[model samples]
Target: MGKITGFMEFERLEEGYRPVPERLKHYKEFVVRLTDEQAGVQGARCMDCGTPFCNSGCPVNNVIPDFNDLVYRQDWKDAFTVLDSTNNYPEFTGRICPAPCEAACTLNVNDDPVGIKSIEHAIADKAWEQGWVQPRIATIKTGKKVAVVGSGPAGMAAAQQLARAGHDVTLFEKNDRIGGLLRYGIPDFKLEKFQIDRRVEQMKAEGVTIRTGVMVGKLPKGSRVTNWAKETISPEELRAQFDAVVLTGGAEQSRDLPVPGRDLEGVHFAMEFLPQQNKVNAGDKVKGQIRADGKRVIVIGGGDTGSDCVGTSNRHGAKSVIQFELMPQPPEQENKELTWPYWPYKMRTSSSHEEGCEREFAIATKEFVGENGKLTGLKTVQVEWKDGKMAEVPGTEKVYEADLVLLAMGFVSPVATILEGFGVDRDNRGNAKATTDFDGGYATSVPGVFAAGDMRRGQSLVVWAIREGRQAARAVDEYLMGFSDLPR
Candidate 1:
């Protein structure tokens, strides 16, 4: 517990952000972190709940109450120790996680939830500021080698943990940069690359060897994470070279909207457009930048990717921007009694949505109307949920001018190269087939080749990817050494 009656004393403090006008001008992060005094007050709001559901609610199982109490007591060192005990990378989660812990806060039953994520952001940012974050290399060497495929959160977390466990860890990334989606798929405006670079340096100091520009398995001549892979190694070769291999390449197959004029020149998968901007922000001059400048941009899909596209388009100074969602608009507020201690269903308006843009819900894209081998407009119709299915309203069909069409509909599965090369099984959802049991957890169908993260679990948050990676590292360590001390 924090302050005896802190919940009654301090109100929840939401993280601040720069206004859209200021933030959209540059491809950099503009989120305002909580002040030290504010963080301390918010930390004090943690109650003496017999069961801290926030801990369980978090995918990474972050120790919520312990750190809250520590920060409240002004014990900075101990707070970080507690925080790093479970989450391998708080910085990543602080920026990208949805913070389900806030939803599960005990105080949320009646009052506003403790500012758990805000406090976490402050703590992690402060730790970095004070140079408190450093390498935690082991004193003893176990003489074991582990290879982590993919440099996303899951692979990065597992590599760090396994290396600290006295193993020689080598992390392989198909991209030129270490972070997989974080380095490419995600725009820099949301998360600055420096945050990832500093952490990567720390991991390197901890004896984790990151091998960027290296793809695994028998890949096509052009298949790579980004536009950067110097060499390709097969799965059998990796198994022969390393003691154990972990597959965490992530689900990269973009779900396509197969409709008329899908092959138009201005239409592209969101990944193709988003990554180019990220590379440009990283100071790499992409020959052909997929830009929305001076064009009527239309983003399809309503989730995080779509929101990201909307924000990116605004930043690009598009002529006009619009987003379409097939699902009906959800209620603004959730029924607390029915959804307490669990994530609730409600309308989520992101920061990108706050920026100037037209959003239409309960509408389905009928087709892409193109001219002269280019997308000219989009056909749409009003939709309603009827008899457990979406039915279009008659006479509600409409068309809107669009020069650039970005399909932000989300990913379907991991690319088929490595899975097929290793003969790894796949689930019905097209993710890597694996179990989460204490015994042989995260082990892939192919022996000596394990799987974790988005590649294993399909599309999910960065926090969940880190959790899977950390747990998979523990499993791999146990399998190698019979007994291990790595945490899940």
Candidate 2:
């Protein structure tokens, strides 16, 4: 508590963004960061409540109050130390996380919450500038080999942790580079590839072997999810070569819109369209890439992915961009009294949404209307909830012209073939079946095999992925040495 009265004296100030006109012309990060002094002021606004719900609200259980106090006192190094203790990738979370911690902030109940995410961003950037972010090499070698399949946040965190614990860790990725989704799934306007490259360099310096363009197991035939694997190693070979294997591959099976004319040309899955642009941004030439230029684009599904499509389409100079949500629009703000200390349902206008978009809520697509195998328009109807069931309005059926349709529905589960190759049991939801308990947690039905992140819990936030990775690392460590000294 650097300043007990600071919360009463200060109002919340969010980070700024570049002007939309200027930012829309390029595919780079546009959000302006908080200066050191601004971060200090924001940190001082923390009330340092007895419960400190922001800590629990954060997926990685960061010591929020301690970092806030440290930042408020101008102890920047200590602030980074506290933040890095819980989160291995604070930069990623600071940039992209929805900040559920803010929703659970004690001050949020009666006033604006402290700008914790902005302060975190400032601290992480400052730490990097000051050369405080360096490789932490283990002192002793354990003579144990651990194989981590997938180079996303979870796999990276687990590989780093296991390497620091003196185990020989090898990380495998199917893509030509590291960072499973971060490198390709996310747009460069949100997160640049250099951030991932910097961390990859650090991980390599920490003695972790990173193998790219190598798939750990076979993908199902005709699967469309991104994969540049020129070589595939059998699961049995991995189990035989490594002391333990950790599965951190993310859920890649996108949920499809199986309606009439789904097979029409110019209609594509969000993954199919988004990754091409990302590849182009990385200076790779893509053949017959999906373009939105001068086209009437309709993005189905209302979520982050859909919002991303909106942004990318705008960048592509699409003629018009429209987004549809089947659910009713939420309130602009949540009732804090009723939803305090938990993630609340409220209308969230992302930076992408603010750029430009026509949002339609309580709407459902009836069928994709096409002519001669190319998409032309779609038939839709307004819907209403009656007794918690969806019912289409009788007279609200309408048609809208469209040149391209991007289905941004979220992913369903991990690719089935990889899970099947390892013989890992699956949950009812089709995710890898594994527990998060302290005793033998993250262990699959098969011995010496583990699962974490999206592979175990289905698609979720990056912060959640890091949390699971750290916890799974501790579990794997315990399994290896009969006990673990690593933090969970």
Candidate 3:
């Protein structure tokens, strides 16, 4: 719909990055965004298919075709409006989200899809540059008080929506800063803290009360999860103060490897390593920060988190870096016919991997070898899968040298004590037990309490978190008022 033959004329263009040597020196964002004309050309490639599977493919269900067409016409303001109608934080997703929308595009059936993510990035940056993103204050007051726990994307979206609907909303964060993982877990080079700062300012302008450094409930004693709360508010106090409560906290429990030498001094969780650098980058003095400089680093678990570890280690000037994955290597290209319009399985390489790293697939760590109470190396064996079970090859066992090790095996669930404090029911997987049914969606077993995002669905993408937050807000609005005008 953008142009009669635009799909046939233009090729998919990718966003650029700064040179590795130049970007490694600083912790600022290094992405080179596409120019207005390049973005328009990328938008012209959208086919505006009859079904538009990209809508459903995207977690927030963005109106992809309409926005793409508008971008092609150079109507950037209208494009931003269309984008804002569905997604609350395109800036976060445009930079980091694995764009399933592009995978589901009609053109992707045979050729490269439209550069939807880059176009989205352009539109969001353009809107902010032109001062179009401003606080939308409520004209009338509903006088209903709501409490939203966590300051992650989900809580942020829910708070913004409820504030727009005229509800008195108070967002609580345990961390000294507002953003939960976005503030600490994410590397600064990927997304700067200023993005979160501007959004917080806008939320304050819209009458949302933000309370940082305050914990709603207690965490388990000796818990490793990051917390900077200087004050504690019991769950009873929160429930008595607010008419409705929404728990949108992230899944923070990191999965651990219970192998020998697990307690070695040099072995640490990914969370412990990543957050320290972010604090230092924010100008906070972190005493005895984790340093990978001149150390041999072995990162276990091959995922985005592991990739992040690789990038950070390289920045710290590590002597060497190696990554391990338990599963066998996938084909470089996916079988499109089998996985059309859905996420496909294939070999993937991140920019960090390009910087420097050795990748070992179908390998499992058997034991961590250490001396002087510090990690020195690890013993591993090659593994093969048969009938959905893994078997280690006997003769392939070997030891690799390492002075530092990072476990980036991903999160298991939200911290247990927070849920236990409120007496909310949990599912088999240890997530909040709540259905997404149209009637009483997101409502917990405890009356007046609800859960969404990682608190309900376990760990997932930021876009998915935003979707849950928006839908949960609608559910809360309907519970407060007989009907909700909010979009799901």
Candidate 4:
């Protein structure tokens, strides 16, 4: 610990956001990161607890205390070194990841947890600004070739690791752009696209071959999920060329609400709506773009995706935005004594919510009401838990006018085409079936195929994707050379 009693002397300080009015006019990041002094102070707040629960709490098992001490001592480079050792993209996680590590912090038991995410953001940004982040080109070329399907976080991490391990790695993406979900799913106001661009450039410098606009497997016919592939490679051809294949694509199968009027014209999946805005932000033209402008928008689902819809709707100058959550609202605060050192169930309000969103909890949409094949409104009912199931309360039916309905429900599983193409086994939930065993983990039933991230574990956080990617790289490395020195 850099300062034994420093925790007692400092209070948590959060990063600031630009004014809502000014930020809504453009799709750019509004978060004002912590300055170096503020980050150092935040680092000082890391207590000298014997067990660093935060390390275990983080998906990648980052060396939290070491980086906190390094940051506290103003050793920015070493702090970044420690951070980079674990996370491939601190910039991505620092911006969007909900810090589970903070919830598991010792201080969170009674006091505010150390601002680990903010500190990591500062360190990552400083590292980039100081040119500390550069290409780690391999000096030795191992003769193995690896194919990474999907250019999202997991695929990107795996490709970079295998490339650095001296293997020829080619990352394939269906979209015209490299980043999978991050390139399209997330709004630019939360995470700028340039962040991904720089990393893509770095990966290229490290000898990873990036092949965008290339689909290794077919997408379902007429699927609305983003795909701009100009070329297609059969699974057999891919497997023949690469010594190992890693499936790191996201779970693109969005859960749908199959109520009445689901065929309405203005009704859409969050994926269908989100990617268009991102493409527009990237200067790509989309025909008949779904806009929330002057529309009464109803976003169903209470997760991050729903929050993103709210934000994007506000940016579109929507007339009104309402978000519905099927579950009852969680308590504003969690009972620390009972839930310490673990993620807590509590009310979470995003910056988007604060920007102007009427959130309705314990509410379920009964039916989408429309006329002339266009969404006009929705019928809803107040739900309550009876015994162990949600039951609609009597006399609680209501209707709300809405011009656009965005189903922000989370994804159920990965698209079936890729798994079918590879002939890989699927778990009960339809995710690619694989184990995380140290000896031969991330390996699918197929001999040379591996699966990781959302494709293997279902939809999850970016940090989890990075962890899976790095570990999968190790598994592939060992499979190729009969030994691997890569970190798991």
Clashes of each: 0, 0, 0, 0
Q: Candidate 3's C-alpha lDDT?
A: 0.93
Q: What RMSD value applies to candidate 3?
A: 0.8
TM values, all candidates: 0.97, 0.99, 0.99, 0.99
Ranking of predictions according to lDDT: 4, 2, 3, 1
What shift in Å separates residue 367 of candidate 3 from its native position after superposition?
A: 0.9
Query: Which residue pairs collide, candidate 3?
Result: none
Clashes of 2: 0
Best by lDDT: 4
What's the distance in Å from true for residue 348, model 3? 1.2
What tens-digit string does per-residue lDDT give for candidate 4 at 262-350? 99889999999999999999998999999999999999999999999999999999999999999999999999999988899999999
TM-score of 2: 0.99
lDDT of 2 by residue, 1-488 (tens): 75799999999999999999999999999999988788889988999578999999999998998999999999999999999999999888889889999999999998999998998888888889999999999999999999999999999999999999999999999988888778878888999888899999999999999999898888888898899888889999999999999999999999998989898998998988888999999999999999999999999999998999999999999999999999999999899899998999999899999999999999999899988899999999999998999999999999999999999889999999899999999999999999999899999999999999999999998889999999999999999999988999
Candidate 3's residue-wise lDDT over 384-424, tens digit each? 99999999998999999999999999999999999998999
Give model 1's TM-score versus the native structure: 0.97
Error of 2 at 428 (Å): 0.4
Report the Cα lDDT for candidate 4. 0.94
